[model samples]
Target chain A: MAHEVTVLTAGELRGLVQLDLAAVDVVERAFAALASGTVVMPPILSMAIPEANGEVDVKTAYIPGFDGFAIKVSPGFFDNPKLGLPSLNGLMILFSARTGLVEALLLDNGYLTDVRTAAAGAVAARHLAPAKVETATVIGTGIQARLQIEAAHLVRPFSRVLVWGRDMAKAEACAADIAERLKITAEAVADPARAVAQSQLVVTTTPAEHPVFKAEWLHPGLHITAMGSDQAGKNEIEPAALVAADLYVCDRVSQCEALGELRSAIAAGLWQGGTPPELGEIVTGRHPGRCSDDEITICDLTGTGAQDTAIATSTIAAARKAGAGSTILT
Target chain B: MAHEVTVLTAGELRGLVQLDLAAVDVVERAFAALASGTVVMPPILSMAIPEANGEVDVKTAYIPGFDGFAIKVSPGFFDNPKLGLPSLNGLMILFSARTGLVEALLLDNGYLTDVRTAAAGAVAARHLAPAKVETATVIGTGIQARLQIEAAHLVRPFSRVLVWGRDMAKAEACAADIAERLKITAEAVADPARAVAQSQLVVTTTPAEHPVFKAEWLHPGLHITAMGSDQAGKNEIEPAALVAADLYVCDRVSQCEALGELRSAIAAGLWQGGTPPELGEIVTGRHPGRCSDDEITICDLTGTGAQDTAIATSTIAAARKAGAGSTILT
Candidate 1:
């Protein structure tokens, strides 16, 4: 029998999905599913074309009970920006779990990745950050910087957002976008340490080759979301900062050790704790998150297929509900 | 700038590709590229959905100078046959190596895989088998049994063909198809040894869990192409037969040892020859393929990603020339 595969575009997805707590809940559910012991997630398939300064990673997870699973193709070419194309772009192909037949192709051009990643950050912060976050700082001027801060506001309703970047012009532009979108006081901070010291929640979204924030800047009642460092050799926070944190949780502990900021901490011997519990453990109540307002907490997120599958699931459903995207028969 | 992605269907691809020496050369080129050591192929990403008895593997390779690379998704559902669906089906996604943008989506539904696999077999036989081949035998009665025979006839026009299968009825039907397609005298042989002794070149394409052919059946001046056992623990020839052969080669030594017929041969301790040279080495004259007509040579094939990329490259070009598929924008 022939099948019609639903195809949704990035614009259609953005128009259908609102950045809100509901998104946070969807990601949180994925975390719980990850902790449920029935998800079969293979190691990511990563191939690099160094001549082009590009790499593509394919990630997927098959949750036994779900009707669908997603395979995400994420391509990152550092030189793309010089050619006026975004540095990151790719799509997701979702298949039926029962028959291994493709159900839909989500050509969101990384929109779903951005959405799920932000929702994951917000969910992590909600469980680990202080009850009330008055200010949030994001240390990057990329699309992720603005999106992560906006996602943080969804969880805690932060009134102020501080942005920092190597390129001050991009930083100022990012801050302006945040202010206009959230109707909040958004400022471009020249000093990352100052932003870290003043804010209750800090989000690191840069593709930093070295530490972007210092250990001396961490405060007692602070929570940090390290959204960068999804690849090896990318770091955001000083190892000493991780050592100082009373609670250091990762979106997925194994991934953090292999591909996130926590890898550097472990290599530096600053994070000596025996396999820190995952963010999913806390979300599922398998472990307690933050003990007190004064306890420093850090969540190192390297992203996961579970989150991608969840967002793809919800995105396709919403697209169908709104009658969005084109349909092609196969 | 946005790009339009070409989409080709299985029927279109089947219509465009003719099994011949040109196809054989395409696969041979891929083998040469693999031997050249410039191909960047990551470990296959495989995820299993146990409840459904299904598994999906994604394979790709980036040849440094190619304009595009292919990511092939191959899905296998053991129970699909019972549901009136093929047990294996999937497609390949081709992307621009320079910009990391999708160049095309080959919805060939495993047609490209089938093509390249058969072509590889024929290529191996061309370089390894004796120049004069009058008769050939094929084990198994599925699509591959017919395709492999047709593909082999392109390289060496055999006047007679022998077909063998576990089911005699299917074997007779397969022989009938071969006779009609190749305009040759084809017979369904009941005895494996009789078939081996009657043919100059033999091809085995079964999915046997245990050895289906034995060493006692080996004939002097004959070459065998073991195309089964692409996955672990599947065997076609007796380990003793591999040991009896004077020359043994594989498409890839590492893959053959890990997942092909050689894996079992090594386990049974019937073959202890140190890592055999790959067929590409002989193709490039790095090693001589056959020393004499009576060498009793065997070629164990465990397919590679290079073949997938190469076939995908040509398939897309052919589809473009034929105007055989739809176009979608991303």
Candidate 2:
């Protein structure tokens, strides 16, 4: 049988997909499907290349109603910056759900991952953040720091943004970029605790091996989205913060227990409540996300294959409609 | 930094690689690397799409000293034949071990998997099959049946082959194909027991849920390579047959126990010996493969990710040298 696969470059994907409300809705639907318990997502297959200081993770999910499923390959090489390259990049391959044939190769160079991840934060904020927000804080100086702030602004029209990082210069640069891009008041804060205390919503986006957000800073009406702890040995929130929060949610319960803030919380003996509700449950209205403005909420976003599948599926559809990629016959 | 990936179609891969001695050697080296204990191979990530009567598996391994590693995606839709589509088709993506950047996209549509799987059979026969073999039998009239006979011929130089299957007509067709392809005498036998008793080497390649090769047919100096059982609930050899053999080896012990013939053997309470030696162990000389020609041997080939990495690395290298694929820069 003749087979054809559409190949989209990162440049084309950037033109096709953005961190907009539509992207947020697509990811939100994925969470709802995940809540339906029909999404088949396996644990990630990861390999570490110690010699090169690199690691690669393969993730996939099969959503029942989707026309296609996506298998995403993400690689993180810490030392790549030394070679004047970004530390993280990879691609996703979409296959026909019925025929199991190749449909598209999404060479997004981690752009889709970035958008999906940030959109997940937006979903969390849309469901769990305070009704009124004047200030938002992002605890990192990475690409996600900017994206998370932009995503949060889409849900909650926060006027002021604070960027916090260990490196003050990078933080200042990031804050400047956000200010120029969003045309809002943005500042680089030296202290994360003060930033969290003042902001109504906080998003952590660092690859820190220790907590960057503290429990003492988590105040009433504040929602924290911790997204950097997607791998073992990485943490961005204090374990006690989960215990202090009125409602603690996860992207996926099992994944958070292994690779999210819940791991550290369990390890520190701070998490006594077993199996927290997932974001999907909240999205499906099975669990109330935030009952009151005074309640402190935290959402652990470890990212998921369902999000990748949803975003890839949507991106390919858009690409096909726009005729944005080259097709190769096999 | 600019990134480039080579995309090789199945036709290009077929032109670059073949079911030959070199392929066998590459697979043999992978076995050796696996036994060395440095190959980082994660458990396969699989999902069942019951709605489509299909299943997809993602397998990857990082073998040290290799420039690249392959992540192979294999999809099997059992009902595809009705739609005039092959049941199995997929692709592999090879990534740079150093930079974690994609090196190649192998659109082989399961062709490389076929060659590597057949080469593994040849590796088993080379190590376990007795010398001076005049007749060999294949216990299925599938693609692997012909490949197994041809692969074994590369090692044992078997003069005659017997093809056995449930359908006599299909068996005769496979036998005729093998006879014409290899220029050797081949026959289709209805009696599986008689075929086993007459042959010095036998390779079972059926996806039967129950045992297809009986223990009573075991004869001295016969080497049985069971390559069919790579998933749970699929067994080709009777459980008692494992106990009847003098020596039993595996491509991978844990995989075999879960997905290969050994799963049935253990369930039948017949496998008393704990943790049998692997094919890699035999390749590395850690275990004597065949003590004597009179000893009955069984090697369970459940396949491995290491072979995929090895074959993919070699294929890409050959493709690069031959300039056989299109390169896309991202």
TM-score, per-candidate, Cα-based? 0.95, 0.99
User: In model 2, how large is the Cα lDDT of residue B147?
Assistant: 89
Sliding window of 10 residues with minimal summed lDDT for model 1 chain A: A1-10
| lDDT of model 1, residue B142 | 90
Candidate 1's C-alpha runs over 4 A off are: B269-271
* Top DockQ hit: 2
Tens digits of per-residue lDDT, candidate 1, B1-330, equal 456888776777778887878899999998888878788988778888989999898988887667889988888888988988887778888888888888887776677888888998898888888777898999999988998898888888989999999999999999999999988999898987788888889999998989887888888888889998877859998999888988888888878988788999999987778888788887888888898887788999877888888988888888878778888776
Docking class of 1: medium
Q: Candidate 1: lDDT of B254?
A: 77
User: For candidate 2, what's the RMSD?
Assistant: 1.1
Cα misplacement distance, residue B282 of candidate 2 (Å): 1.0
Largest TM-score belongs to which candidate?
2
lDDT for A227 in candidate 2 is: 94
Could you give the fnat of all candidates in order? 0.69, 0.79
**Cα RMSD of predicted structure 1:** 2.0
